[model samples]
Target: MSPPPPDRLARWLCHPHFFKVVLLLALVISAPTVAIGFYADDYVLLSYLAGRIPGSPPWYDLYNFFDGDALKLQANLVSGFPWWTDPGLKLHLVRPLASALFTLEHAVFGHAPLGYHLVSIALYVALVAAAGRLFLRVLPGATGALALFLFAVCDNHLHPVGWIACQHLLLAALPAVLGLLAYLRYREEGWRPGRYLGPLGLGVGLLGGEAALGGAAYWIAYQLAGPVPPGRAAGLRARAAAALPALGLLAYFAAYKAVGGGAANTGGYVDPLASPLRFAAAAAERLPVLLGDALVSMPADLTSALPSGPFVAVGLAAVAGLALLYRACLPAIPERERAALRWLVPGALLALVTSLGGFPGSRLLLLPSLGIAPLLAVVILRGLRRGPSPGRAAWPRRAGAGLLAAVHVAIAPLLFLAATASSADIARKLEGVARTAELGAPPRERAFIAAASDPMVTIYPQAILGLASPDALPCWSALSMARASHRLTRTGPSSFTLEPLGRTMLTGAFETLYRAPSAPIPRGYQVTQCGATIRVAEVEDGKPSRLEVDLGAPLEDPGLALLSWRDGRLRRMALPAIGEAVELPWSPGPIGLL
Candidate 1:
């Protein structure tokens, strides 16, 4: 009998011939990441490598604008800790392999951003290609094909691909991917070829990074998922062998943490000895979100800003594609493969929950996809087939699957566009900060870098060094200034007090005071180099507000100007000096050139 329309359509779409097209699209979609500049934590990496962080000059009370009063960055420096004794570095979490890769890149590429982007893309592309092939091997027929396509296209969790600091996820995940592949081979080809390779992959993955360790659960899940052998003794032996990797990983983590091995434990982990309940609660809460982000394309971080019209299109497409592909792919999967998901599901859950002691970001989701991807494939197959012997899928079920699949397929491309836009946005902002530094920064030691154009709450390196160089580096950054933001005004104009927040000195050539005001100030309240501040009352809320009040003599006569930093471009307010009022009648405050 001729196959039904949906089944025929699925076969064509899931064909192996189409995989090359998906691979090509993956490359194209990810290429724009080259445009992204080094941002935030990327600078932290540079700072540490330069040895500026570990050995900050005694004179610097609080180093850099990014390092607040606490000297948190200074503490995480890997220099002081001996690896054999104390594995943890104060400033960073320990991921030796990932760190080594970044160091190697820097040695080769230096400050060039494009080189790092390319390297990451190359590695990720290879990983994706492997994933697609692996899916084809395990699941039967078109199910594997469809799953491979899904693996290639779906990259909503792409932090590792874009961010320099997040490459650990990719590094750790690669080994796990290898392990899964080797396990599949072992299941098919028996002892000699697959036995040693599978466990070796898993064990290496454990030491590579914490994300790598999540694969143990996947190993367990894979072994027990299918039909069991006739002998209980055989099953027990198989399970025991599978358990070795997980046990080794546990032993490694215990030893690593005991000596204070550096780990990415920001709010995610508390010392079990110190507070077990807190750790347990955090893991419990994070488990659901982690699974949700992996299986569902509904992560709030990336999607909140998405336009409604496109989102609806994405949603409708997913519903339709999933519906159609589910029917096409389901029957093809062997019953044994379907059982594999039982282990895959729990493995993914355990991997995420156990790995993070604190909150997990979507960037960390890439590793979990190893187990989740296979599990999701199994789910898709089961939902479509519905039973041991299947007839034509119901209309409602087909429609549902098609829509879901379409959303997944469509969103991948859309997310690629969004990531590109985000990278461009970061570059643009970095440029604006650079411009501001060129015009205003002084060739001096200390600088008061009030965060005038902050997209997020914390100050970034872009605000301080203009995204390049430490005093030690060959090239000096914009303004060639070491920026500090001593606490400034809060509340209203009356409550405003311009003074150093902590012990950190604002004694450089310029003491810039940045402010984001609630209400508009009357004329002459603050200086603006750009225009008359009298009408500065026209300034709106949540906008960047800067007033340049020149210090004629220490706290004496003041000259005024206004600076507006918007749209990743800056307009310097160079209004010739009007006498300064140290206190404003509610001025956004004066920002002086150092």
Candidate 2:
């Protein structure tokens, strides 16, 4: 059917208070995330700032940030840690206020995960509210509600809100933008913008290094959507006026640095330039997971419900609706009206780009996504105006809205399922079973069985680390641990050690050898004796053994034998594959997974 008239659509949208009320209602509805568990990254940031150790450091703590690897940049900030090698490395350079606030929260909340979750949830709610406020002001007659929903769950943010660690993006962005919005409102009233001095200053100060980033983002949005000045001289003056806020933003950023204690050491991560290429290449290969992440962080079982098909569908639909609005309504918007939107959309885009430096995910995109709501609302409003008649106007908009809302409903339960389906609970149960299963065996007998069943904890020069099966542990944790330890330490140009190996190495190496690889055995084993070479046969019973070897011998073998180590219980086995390593199934006693 053909679309109805425009005036009727405009009349429907021009309702006096629907926008504000609906916006408020949405905030009220989604505010409960605070009650949820602190998802992953929330734990990391909070723990770091509060200086709490979750457990022993994994072997690679020397280079990893979680191990205090980022301590090199700071002048005097000493990291509190288990990984003590790089104590003052400055890893996080930009967000001192975030770290400081985390410390403050810890002081008040003291490792209560709930408190962190609540703060994150509250900030999310506030951000939603502020977005609504901005929408009401900028799009007064637009479909602000659609924009609000889009901001909430359009991307892979479902789990990000729940994840306690990654909520900093939202937490920092909310107050900073709300403060600017308030300042903008004050300015619109022709009130002395100086009255905003308090809120603006506080927001910037609280945000610290992020203040500049946040302010720059807001200014970009303002420039895009605020009124363009009348011609040359006036435009210059307007530009200068805008520059004032920019200056204020920059001043606070500098102050953040001056406050000292930037992030300790930037952690030895894959370089950003390197990551984008890897990400791009991995994009095609891992589209399913990538898209899945853009929707929610559910457990594997929940993936079926919120599958990639539906996520891509909703995302595409949202894009279509946005396109319609931008195409149809943008031309009709007044120069001044369009200014604010122009300021925000591009600004938000810029923020998104910067935030995605080496990685792009729901958590990283939260603020930028939230900031663009006003622009999106403007689009939806215009789309609504293009409808046929008053009765028909909202029908198309409603259809689009209904689909969007349904997506949220379909997605919410999946999020809950994910939170509950933790592998940690599974692993704990497994350990209990193992204790009973091995009951009454002699210590040596038990050790051999343990080694046979355990995941390898360490990979020596000749040995490879391994992990229990994914069914026994969560794939995420298994993968996480495996990745944490499989690297050789990079010493000066000439020196290196095997400590750089991360969790992935243990898992992969273990899986390969434990599962069996197609290769021939290198038959002979040689060990050093006092000025002599000695040969030893592979032990067949999978029991602990110590075979003496000659030292100072120039035999071809370099202690090249497979060993299964558990609680110091060692079993010598034939090294099956030369290029690949094997993993015994037992967990390591003195191992960490940071």
Candidate 3:
């Protein structure tokens, strides 16, 4: 059967424009979930936001782009202290937007995961659509769609899209790419030179927020891809011949700085040239991982790909298609049909400069790689369009296009499934309420217990509607409080001074308090058992502070100090340690070891 000549739907599906739109639709579907609750770098920001921590809302909390006062809104509640939280120099505020939106969702959804996750998914979807549309507009063909799909589905992209905190990177890339597209169009038409200024200006402004480097990469690509007089020599001299784009870039840089653009400094966090050899190796190694991530669903027992048998068959077909294009089809390609290849050189260079871990990291490659996709797509589609007789070529072209399309589109459902499971796993780990009960008595019942339980979980206060709501601590706030006070803060028996055994003994006392039945021991160091209590008898400060317990754990070592209040009335213990439970009585502080 001849398939009764293609119907409107069939023709539309095969149309390059339709396929591009379909890709756009896929992008839209992915955006919402990509903007959900904070992840990765967000933890640093959230640490500063907790009311229990010493620091108040930080200055330039969100990329520091806006006025100082706006950033202070996220401070810790109890102490009106401000924290300059980010180690990275840039006041990148992308997280603030995500945090603010998540905060709003928190108000309405009451900590349910779905609402925030939906936002991230939606943002990713929009990003994918924007990228596809951008490519199709530049070069319309099966190849264009294929390139966009590959960029979208590639495994490296999963981290940026799936992780909520990375939305800034995505949001920034979208407008920047659009602006490049607009600028390219402006240049192509020899339109009013001043008109090129507008899109260029917008691209720079957006670049300041998500990623300055990404914006710079695209600008470089534009200059490389731009048309020059046919006889002009390449390199710096060619750019000098027509300096409009250079001027535009200069203006863009000035505007971006004026708008308060800067990225967080990662000076010590990641060595600028951390193991370039290793990174390159990792990138090469990740190719298979990326492919599997993009194409396979989680818990692989549920779904599988066509075996290697079919993959080899398809690979052969693709190779044959490429061979036919160069050998038998190149001569037929129209002269005007080809665009300049000058851009690829610079684009490749730009990609190299920005690439991290070779070719795999999405944050590093996504935007720069956009330039390469369309060019590859056009070449591939052109080959398919010309090979075989017109009648025979039609089926092969359509089949090839479909195969490419399937590979890209299938990525979304697979990624979606994997992300769903991953998010669920993370959510389960955060279900602290149930775990809190297992400890028996509330942590607050004793200072030692509270301190001991701090590692496992500690719920701290958050300011709610202008009221300091210390008791109603959420998991995020609690974890932030525990980490900031116990780890970051610099008040305590020096963690460095304690031997491994001493530290464990000290930690075990705190844990014991939380496990103990209801009782009031002492504010600082005292033990309550069998009705009466035994407090530390004396204190001496020499090389390290020391205390004498009345009737608790005996000295495991003379160096170990027994901290007590008043033997009865000390307000607090500066730094205390216990030798034995029966002789040297001691209690852990509310902030745990700190």
> What lDDT would each prediction earn against the true structure?
0.49, 0.41, 0.39
Q: Give candidate 2 misplaced runs (Cα > 4 Å).
A: 1-35, 41-90, 93-97, 152-161, 194-212, 229-233, 248-325, 328-339, 384-594
**Which numbered prediction scores highest in lDDT against the true structure?**
1
lDDT over C-alpha atoms for residue 228 of model 2: 48
lDDT of 3 by residue, 142-235 (tens): 4445656556655445545666545556655666666655665555654465346535644543443434345556556556555553455558
TM-score for each of the candidates: 0.67, 0.54, 0.52
lDDT ranking of the models: 1, 2, 3
> Candidates ranked by TM-score, best first?
1, 2, 3
Q: Candidate 2 or 3, higher TM-score?
A: 2
TM-score of 3: 0.52
Better of 1 and 2 by lDDT: 1
lDDT, candidate 2, residue 572? 47
lDDT (tens digit, per residue) of candidate 2 on 181-262: 7666555654466346525744653454342364456555564445643442346566566556556545654664454423
TM-score of 1: 0.67
The per-prediction CA RMSD against the true structure, in angstroms, equals 10.7, 12.2, 13.7
Ten-residue region with minimum lDDT total, candidate 2? 461-470
Error of 3 at 277 (Å): 13
